[model samples]
Target: MKKNIFLVLMGILSVVSHVCAQSLPQETSQSIGIIEFVLKNSKYEDTKCDIHSCQMKSKDGGVSLTLTHATMKQDKEEDLHYLLKINVQGTLFSTKVEVRYRNDPSKQTMKTGKRSDEVDSSYKTEHRVLRSWIQFIKDSTTSKS
Candidate 1:
Protein backbone atom coordinates (compact mmCIF):
# COMPACT_ATOMS: atom_id res chain seq x y z
CA MET A 1 0.00 0.00 0.00
CA LYS A 2 1.07 3.63 -0.54
CA LYS A 3 0.88 4.40 3.15
CA ASN A 4 3.05 1.39 4.04
CA ILE A 5 5.70 2.40 1.50
CA PHE A 6 5.78 6.00 2.77
CA LEU A 7 6.12 4.81 6.36
CA VAL A 8 9.04 2.55 5.49
CA LEU A 9 10.84 5.36 3.65
CA MET A 10 10.32 7.76 6.52
CA GLY A 11 11.66 5.26 9.03
CA ILE A 12 14.76 4.66 6.93
CA LEU A 13 15.38 8.40 6.60
CA SER A 14 15.08 8.87 10.34
CA VAL A 15 17.56 6.09 11.02
CA VAL A 16 20.07 7.56 8.58
CA SER A 17 19.80 11.04 10.06
CA HIS A 18 20.20 9.79 13.62
CA VAL A 19 23.23 7.74 12.71
CA CYS A 20 24.90 10.77 11.11
CA ALA A 21 24.21 13.14 13.99
CA GLN A 22 27.22 14.00 16.20
CA SER A 23 28.00 16.24 19.17
CA LEU A 24 30.33 19.19 18.69
CA PRO A 25 34.04 18.48 19.16
CA GLN A 26 35.78 19.81 22.26
CA GLU A 27 39.31 21.22 22.68
CA THR A 28 41.28 19.50 25.43
CA SER A 29 44.19 20.72 27.51
CA GLN A 30 46.47 19.02 30.01
CA SER A 31 46.59 21.86 32.50
CA ILE A 32 43.61 22.06 34.86
CA GLY A 33 44.32 25.20 36.89
CA ILE A 34 45.29 27.21 33.85
CA ILE A 35 41.66 27.70 32.78
CA GLU A 36 40.61 29.16 36.11
CA PHE A 37 43.75 31.23 36.43
CA VAL A 38 43.37 32.67 32.97
CA LEU A 39 39.74 33.47 33.62
CA LYS A 40 40.53 35.29 36.83
CA ASN A 41 43.34 37.30 35.27
CA SER A 42 41.43 38.03 32.09
CA LYS A 43 41.50 41.58 30.71
CA TYR A 44 37.86 41.56 29.65
CA GLU A 45 35.20 42.97 31.94
CA ASP A 46 33.68 40.30 34.17
CA THR A 47 29.92 40.66 34.08
CA LYS A 48 29.15 37.80 36.45
CA CYS A 49 30.75 34.74 38.05
CA ASP A 50 30.10 31.70 40.19
CA ILE A 51 31.76 28.43 41.20
CA HIS A 52 31.54 26.60 37.88
CA SER A 53 30.51 29.30 35.36
CA CYS A 54 30.99 32.96 34.48
CA GLN A 55 29.57 35.63 32.19
CA MET A 56 31.84 38.18 30.51
CA LYS A 57 31.18 41.15 28.32
CA SER A 58 33.40 43.53 26.39
CA LYS A 59 33.72 47.14 27.49
CA ASP A 60 32.05 48.29 24.29
CA GLY A 61 29.27 45.71 24.87
CA GLY A 62 29.69 44.53 21.32
CA VAL A 63 30.50 40.99 22.47
CA SER A 64 29.16 39.03 25.42
CA LEU A 65 29.99 35.52 26.62
CA THR A 66 28.58 33.05 29.11
CA LEU A 67 30.96 30.15 29.65
CA THR A 68 29.15 26.95 28.85
CA HIS A 69 28.87 24.02 25.02
CA ALA A 70 28.24 22.68 20.90
CA THR A 71 28.50 24.13 17.42
CA MET A 72 26.95 27.14 15.67
CA LYS A 73 23.62 26.74 13.90
CA GLN A 74 21.97 29.54 11.95
CA ASP A 75 18.40 30.62 12.61
CA LYS A 76 15.55 31.71 10.32
CA GLU A 77 15.97 35.40 11.16
CA GLU A 78 19.58 36.60 10.95
CA ASP A 79 18.92 40.02 12.44
CA LEU A 80 17.74 38.81 15.81
CA HIS A 81 20.06 38.43 18.79
CA TYR A 82 21.49 34.99 19.50
CA LEU A 83 23.11 33.19 22.42
CA LEU A 84 26.64 31.91 21.89
CA LYS A 85 27.47 29.03 24.24
CA ILE A 86 31.00 28.05 25.19
CA ASN A 87 31.37 25.12 27.56
CA VAL A 88 34.39 24.29 29.68
CA GLN A 89 34.76 21.02 31.58
CA GLY A 90 37.78 20.61 33.81
CA THR A 91 39.24 17.70 35.72
CA LEU A 92 42.16 17.36 38.12
CA PHE A 93 44.75 17.54 35.34
CA SER A 94 42.90 18.43 32.17
CA THR A 95 40.11 20.52 30.59
CA LYS A 96 37.84 20.44 27.58
CA VAL A 97 36.08 23.26 25.71
CA GLU A 98 33.27 23.41 23.16
CA VAL A 99 31.56 26.47 21.68
CA ARG A 100 28.09 26.76 20.19
CA TYR A 101 26.38 29.77 18.70
CA ARG A 102 22.62 29.13 18.41
CA ASN A 103 22.24 31.52 15.54
CA ASP A 104 25.25 31.08 13.29
CA PRO A 105 27.48 34.13 13.74
CA SER A 106 29.49 33.49 10.63
CA LYS A 107 26.43 34.08 8.48
CA GLN A 108 25.82 37.42 10.21
CA THR A 109 27.69 40.18 8.45
CA MET A 110 28.54 43.75 9.46
CA LYS A 111 27.18 46.84 7.75
CA THR A 112 29.87 49.28 6.62
CA GLY A 113 27.81 52.18 5.35
CA LYS A 114 24.36 53.71 5.43
CA ARG A 115 23.26 51.44 2.60
CA SER A 116 21.59 48.25 3.78
CA ASP A 117 23.51 46.03 1.40
CA GLU A 118 26.86 47.63 2.15
CA VAL A 119 28.84 45.26 4.33
CA ASP A 120 32.41 45.58 5.62
CA SER A 121 33.96 42.47 7.12
CA SER A 122 33.25 39.42 9.21
CA TYR A 123 36.25 40.23 11.47
CA LYS A 124 33.89 42.14 13.75
CA THR A 125 31.15 39.52 13.54
CA GLU A 126 30.12 37.52 16.59
CA HIS A 127 31.65 34.31 15.29
CA ARG A 128 35.09 35.81 14.78
CA VAL A 129 35.11 37.42 18.21
CA LEU A 130 34.04 34.17 19.82
CA ARG A 131 36.78 32.25 18.07
CA SER A 132 39.31 34.88 19.13
CA TRP A 133 38.22 34.65 22.75
CA ILE A 134 38.49 30.86 22.72
CA GLN A 135 41.92 31.02 21.17
CA PHE A 136 43.08 33.55 23.71
CA ILE A 137 41.97 31.37 26.57
CA LYS A 138 43.57 28.31 25.07
CA ASP A 139 46.78 30.12 24.37
CA SER A 140 46.96 31.70 27.78
CA THR A 141 46.09 28.45 29.53
CA THR A 142 48.48 26.25 27.62
CA SER A 143 51.41 28.64 27.37
CA LYS A 144 51.84 28.87 31.13
CA SER A 145 53.87 25.93 32.42
Candidate 2:
Protein backbone atom coordinates (compact mmCIF):
# COMPACT_ATOMS: atom_id res chain seq x y z
CA MET A 1 0.00 0.00 0.00
CA LYS A 2 2.79 2.39 0.86
CA LYS A 3 4.49 1.65 -2.48
CA ASN A 4 1.31 2.39 -4.36
CA ILE A 5 0.91 5.70 -2.49
CA PHE A 6 4.49 6.60 -3.23
CA LEU A 7 4.02 5.88 -6.91
CA VAL A 8 0.85 7.96 -7.01
CA LEU A 9 2.56 10.82 -5.27
CA MET A 10 5.45 10.58 -7.68
CA GLY A 11 3.06 10.70 -10.63
CA ILE A 12 1.38 13.77 -9.21
CA LEU A 13 4.68 15.45 -8.66
CA SER A 14 5.80 14.63 -12.21
CA VAL A 15 2.67 16.13 -13.67
CA VAL A 16 3.04 19.22 -11.56
CA SER A 17 6.60 19.70 -12.63
CA HIS A 18 5.68 19.22 -16.24
CA VAL A 19 3.04 21.86 -16.02
CA CYS A 20 5.39 24.21 -14.28
CA ALA A 21 8.03 23.68 -16.95
CA GLN A 22 5.86 25.30 -19.58
CA SER A 23 7.30 28.48 -21.03
CA LEU A 24 6.17 31.84 -19.71
CA PRO A 25 5.23 34.84 -21.81
CA GLN A 26 8.44 36.25 -23.30
CA GLU A 27 7.11 39.32 -25.05
CA THR A 28 8.96 42.58 -24.50
CA SER A 29 8.66 46.26 -25.38
CA GLN A 30 11.81 45.99 -27.50
CA SER A 31 9.87 44.09 -30.14
CA ILE A 32 7.38 46.91 -30.34
CA GLY A 33 10.18 49.38 -30.70
CA ILE A 34 11.69 47.33 -33.53
CA ILE A 35 8.34 47.25 -35.28
CA GLU A 36 7.89 50.98 -34.93
CA PHE A 37 11.38 51.58 -36.23
CA VAL A 38 10.85 49.30 -39.18
CA LEU A 39 7.59 50.97 -40.10
CA LYS A 40 9.18 54.40 -39.88
CA ASN A 41 12.07 53.47 -42.14
CA SER A 42 10.08 51.36 -44.59
CA LYS A 43 11.05 53.69 -47.43
CA TYR A 44 7.49 54.70 -48.32
CA GLU A 45 6.54 58.27 -49.16
CA ASP A 46 4.69 60.76 -46.93
CA THR A 47 6.50 59.44 -43.87
CA LYS A 48 5.01 62.15 -41.68
CA CYS A 49 1.31 62.75 -42.18
CA ASP A 50 -1.09 60.98 -39.83
CA ILE A 51 -4.18 60.37 -42.01
CA HIS A 52 -5.83 57.89 -39.58
CA SER A 53 -8.47 56.44 -41.94
CA CYS A 54 -9.03 56.32 -45.74
CA GLN A 55 -5.73 57.93 -46.59
CA MET A 56 -2.35 56.45 -45.45
CA LYS A 57 1.23 57.24 -46.15
CA SER A 58 4.74 56.27 -45.00
CA LYS A 59 7.57 58.75 -44.55
CA ASP A 60 9.75 56.88 -47.01
CA GLY A 61 9.09 57.41 -50.68
CA GLY A 62 8.68 53.79 -51.72
CA VAL A 63 5.31 52.67 -50.30
CA SER A 64 2.33 54.23 -48.59
CA LEU A 65 1.54 52.80 -45.14
CA THR A 66 -1.41 52.40 -42.81
CA LEU A 67 -2.08 50.11 -39.90
CA THR A 68 -5.73 49.03 -39.74
CA HIS A 69 -5.87 46.70 -36.75
CA ALA A 70 -3.66 44.37 -34.74
CA THR A 71 -4.26 41.43 -32.43
CA MET A 72 -2.41 38.64 -30.69
CA LYS A 73 -3.31 35.27 -32.18
CA GLN A 74 -3.93 32.41 -29.78
CA ASP A 75 -1.47 29.67 -30.64
CA LYS A 76 1.26 27.53 -29.12
CA GLU A 77 3.89 29.59 -30.89
CA GLU A 78 4.76 33.11 -29.77
CA ASP A 79 3.66 35.11 -32.76
CA LEU A 80 1.56 38.03 -34.02
CA HIS A 81 0.37 39.24 -37.40
CA TYR A 82 -0.36 42.85 -38.31
CA LEU A 83 -2.81 44.02 -40.97
CA LEU A 84 -0.98 46.61 -43.02
CA LYS A 85 -1.87 48.52 -46.21
CA ILE A 86 0.72 50.01 -48.49
CA ASN A 87 0.42 52.19 -51.58
CA VAL A 88 3.23 52.52 -54.09
CA GLN A 89 2.72 56.08 -55.32
CA GLY A 90 4.49 57.98 -58.01
CA THR A 91 4.39 61.35 -59.79
CA LEU A 92 1.36 60.30 -61.84
CA PHE A 93 0.37 56.76 -60.70
CA SER A 94 0.06 54.43 -57.72
CA THR A 95 -0.32 50.77 -56.74
CA LYS A 96 -1.66 48.84 -53.75
CA VAL A 97 0.21 47.08 -50.95
CA GLU A 98 -1.54 44.68 -48.59
CA VAL A 99 0.04 41.98 -46.45
CA ARG A 100 0.62 40.57 -42.96
CA TYR A 101 3.73 39.75 -40.98
CA ARG A 102 3.84 36.75 -38.68
CA ASN A 103 6.35 36.77 -35.81
CA ASP A 104 7.96 39.76 -37.54
CA PRO A 105 8.88 37.85 -40.68
CA SER A 106 7.12 38.97 -43.87
CA LYS A 107 8.06 35.75 -45.69
CA GLN A 108 5.28 34.01 -43.82
CA THR A 109 2.20 34.09 -46.04
CA MET A 110 -1.12 35.35 -44.72
CA LYS A 111 -4.69 35.08 -45.97
CA THR A 112 -5.77 38.50 -47.29
CA GLY A 113 -9.23 39.43 -48.47
CA LYS A 114 -10.54 41.54 -51.36
CA ARG A 115 -10.11 45.30 -51.18
CA SER A 116 -13.11 47.44 -50.33
CA ASP A 117 -13.74 50.91 -51.71
CA GLU A 118 -13.99 51.89 -48.09
CA VAL A 119 -10.45 50.62 -47.71
CA ASP A 120 -7.57 52.70 -48.98
CA SER A 121 -7.45 52.55 -52.81
CA SER A 122 -3.68 52.08 -52.58
CA TYR A 123 -4.20 48.65 -51.03
CA LYS A 124 -6.05 47.37 -54.11
CA THR A 125 -3.20 47.10 -56.56
CA GLU A 126 -1.22 43.82 -56.65
CA HIS A 127 -0.12 40.96 -54.41
CA ARG A 128 3.47 41.16 -55.60
CA VAL A 129 4.00 44.38 -53.68
CA LEU A 130 3.95 42.35 -50.48
CA ARG A 131 7.32 40.97 -51.45
CA SER A 132 8.65 44.47 -51.89
CA TRP A 133 7.38 45.43 -48.47
CA ILE A 134 8.96 42.33 -46.99
CA GLN A 135 12.21 43.11 -48.64
CA PHE A 136 12.11 46.57 -47.19
CA ILE A 137 11.44 45.18 -43.74
CA LYS A 138 14.20 42.60 -43.99
CA ASP A 139 16.65 45.33 -44.91
CA SER A 140 15.40 47.62 -42.16
CA THR A 141 17.59 46.24 -39.38
CA THR A 142 20.67 47.51 -41.17
CA SER A 143 19.46 51.10 -41.21
CA LYS A 144 18.46 51.23 -37.56
CA SER A 145 19.73 54.23 -35.59
Candidate 3:
Protein backbone atom coordinates (compact mmCIF):
# COMPACT_ATOMS: atom_id res chain seq x y z
CA MET A 1 0.00 0.00 0.00
CA LYS A 2 0.98 3.68 -0.10
CA LYS A 3 1.64 3.68 3.64
CA ASN A 4 4.18 0.86 3.27
CA ILE A 5 6.10 2.69 0.57
CA PHE A 6 6.16 5.92 2.59
CA LEU A 7 7.57 4.08 5.59
CA VAL A 8 10.34 2.54 3.49
CA LEU A 9 11.34 5.93 2.10
CA MET A 10 11.40 7.43 5.59
CA GLY A 11 13.66 4.64 6.80
CA ILE A 12 16.14 5.19 3.99
CA LEU A 13 16.21 8.94 4.53
CA SER A 14 16.85 8.50 8.23
CA VAL A 15 19.79 6.20 7.54
CA VAL A 16 21.29 8.66 5.07
CA SER A 17 20.98 11.55 7.48
CA HIS A 18 22.57 9.54 10.28
CA VAL A 19 25.52 8.57 8.15
CA CYS A 20 26.05 12.14 7.00
CA ALA A 21 26.01 13.50 10.55
CA GLN A 22 28.89 11.28 11.72
CA SER A 23 31.47 13.52 10.08
CA LEU A 24 30.51 16.98 11.26
CA PRO A 25 31.87 19.93 9.34
CA GLN A 26 34.55 22.12 10.91
CA GLU A 27 34.04 25.78 11.92
CA THR A 28 36.62 28.50 12.01
CA SER A 29 36.84 30.83 15.02
CA GLN A 30 37.42 34.56 14.83
CA SER A 31 38.43 35.14 18.45
CA ILE A 32 38.41 31.67 19.98
CA GLY A 33 34.98 32.10 21.61
CA ILE A 34 31.24 32.51 21.33
CA ILE A 35 31.52 36.26 20.79
CA GLU A 36 32.42 35.73 17.17
CA PHE A 37 29.55 33.35 16.55
CA VAL A 38 27.00 35.65 18.12
CA LEU A 39 28.07 38.74 16.24
CA LYS A 40 28.64 37.13 12.86
CA ASN A 41 25.65 34.79 12.53
CA SER A 42 23.03 36.99 14.18
CA LYS A 43 20.90 39.35 12.14
CA TYR A 44 22.67 41.93 10.07
CA GLU A 45 20.20 44.56 11.21
CA ASP A 46 20.95 46.96 14.02
CA THR A 47 20.87 45.10 17.35
CA LYS A 48 19.44 46.86 20.37
CA CYS A 49 21.23 45.13 23.23
CA ASP A 50 20.12 45.04 26.82
CA ILE A 51 21.31 43.47 30.06
CA HIS A 52 20.12 39.93 29.26
CA SER A 53 18.95 40.02 25.66
CA CYS A 54 19.57 41.62 22.31
CA GLN A 55 16.89 42.54 19.80
CA MET A 56 17.74 41.75 16.20
CA LYS A 57 16.10 41.34 12.81
CA SER A 58 16.84 38.25 10.78
CA LYS A 59 18.00 39.09 7.28
CA ASP A 60 16.12 36.20 5.68
CA GLY A 61 12.59 37.62 5.88
CA GLY A 62 13.07 40.41 8.41
CA VAL A 63 11.71 38.40 11.34
CA SER A 64 12.49 40.06 14.66
CA LEU A 65 13.89 38.11 17.61
CA THR A 66 13.21 39.88 20.86
CA LEU A 67 14.78 39.00 24.17
CA THR A 68 17.08 36.62 22.41
CA HIS A 69 19.01 33.99 24.37
CA ALA A 70 21.89 31.94 23.07
CA THR A 71 23.66 28.66 23.90
CA MET A 72 27.24 29.89 23.49
CA LYS A 73 29.01 31.45 26.45
CA GLN A 74 31.10 34.57 26.13
CA ASP A 75 34.79 33.98 26.18
CA LYS A 76 37.05 35.95 28.51
CA GLU A 77 38.38 37.91 25.59
CA GLU A 78 34.94 39.22 24.72
CA ASP A 79 32.74 41.67 26.64
CA LEU A 80 29.61 41.25 24.54
CA HIS A 81 28.05 38.20 26.28
CA TYR A 82 28.14 35.88 29.28
CA LEU A 83 30.31 32.85 29.79
CA LEU A 84 28.84 29.46 30.58
CA LYS A 85 31.01 27.36 32.81
CA ILE A 86 30.41 23.64 33.09
CA ASN A 87 32.06 21.17 35.41
CA VAL A 88 32.36 17.74 33.88
CA GLN A 89 34.17 14.90 35.70
CA GLY A 90 35.72 17.51 37.98
CA THR A 91 37.25 19.16 34.95
CA LEU A 92 35.98 22.16 33.08
CA PHE A 93 35.43 22.45 29.36
CA SER A 94 34.56 25.88 28.04
CA THR A 95 32.47 25.21 25.00
CA LYS A 96 31.26 27.45 22.20
CA VAL A 97 27.65 26.38 21.85
CA GLU A 98 24.99 27.89 19.55
CA VAL A 99 22.09 29.94 20.88
CA ARG A 100 18.31 29.68 20.94
CA TYR A 101 16.02 32.67 21.04
CA ARG A 102 12.51 33.32 22.23
CA ASN A 103 10.14 34.76 19.69
CA ASP A 104 8.85 38.30 20.07
CA PRO A 105 6.70 38.01 23.21
CA SER A 106 4.05 40.28 21.75
CA LYS A 107 3.41 37.79 18.96
CA GLN A 108 1.77 34.52 20.00
CA THR A 109 2.41 31.60 17.69
CA MET A 110 1.18 28.70 19.79
CA LYS A 111 -2.31 27.32 20.17
CA THR A 112 -4.93 29.13 22.21
CA GLY A 113 -5.75 28.39 25.90
CA LYS A 114 -2.23 27.08 26.55
CA ARG A 115 0.15 28.89 28.88
CA SER A 116 3.67 29.69 27.67
CA ASP A 117 5.24 27.17 30.09
CA GLU A 118 2.72 24.51 29.13
CA VAL A 119 3.52 24.73 25.42
CA ASP A 120 7.24 23.90 25.40
CA SER A 121 10.53 25.75 25.29
CA SER A 122 9.96 29.49 25.21
CA TYR A 123 13.00 29.83 22.99
CA LYS A 124 11.40 28.69 19.76
CA THR A 125 13.78 29.75 16.99
CA GLU A 126 17.10 28.06 16.52
CA HIS A 127 20.03 30.07 15.15
CA ARG A 128 21.08 27.43 12.66
CA VAL A 129 23.98 29.48 11.31
CA LEU A 130 25.40 30.14 14.75
CA ARG A 131 24.78 26.56 15.81
CA SER A 132 26.74 25.27 12.86
CA TRP A 133 29.66 27.44 13.87
CA ILE A 134 29.67 26.05 17.38
CA GLN A 135 29.40 22.47 16.19
CA PHE A 136 32.23 23.00 13.75
CA ILE A 137 34.62 24.22 16.44
CA LYS A 138 33.64 21.52 18.91
CA ASP A 139 34.10 18.68 16.46
CA SER A 140 37.42 19.89 15.11
CA THR A 141 38.93 20.45 18.55
CA THR A 142 37.51 17.50 20.48
CA SER A 143 38.06 14.94 17.75
CA LYS A 144 41.72 15.83 17.49
CA SER A 145 42.60 16.55 21.11
| Index of the highest-TM-score prediction | 2
lDDT of 3 at 124: 26
For lDDT, the strongest prediction is 2
How many residue pairs clash per model? 3, 9, 3
The residue pairs found clashing in candidate 1 are 68-86, 68-87, 69-87
TM-score of each: 0.24, 0.30, 0.22
Residues 68-87, model 3: lDDT tens digits: 33334422222223222111
Q: State which candidate, 1 or 3, has the greater TM-score.
A: 1
| Stretch of 10 with least lDDT, candidate 1 | 23-32
Q: What is the lDDT of candidate 2?
A: 0.43
Which order, best to worst by lDDT?
2, 1, 3
Please, what is the whole-model Cα lDDT of each candidate in the order they appear? 0.40, 0.43, 0.35
Error of 3 at 31 (Å): 28
Instruction: Please give, for residues 78-123, the per-residue lDDT of candidate 1 as tens digits.
Output: 3423333433333333223334333334542222122112112232
Taking all chains together, the TM-score of candidate 1 against the true structure is 0.24
Residue pairs in steric clash, candidate 2?
44-60, 44-61, 44-63, 45-60, 45-61, 46-58, 47-58, 47-59, 96-122
| lDDT accuracy of residue 60 in candidate 1 | 42
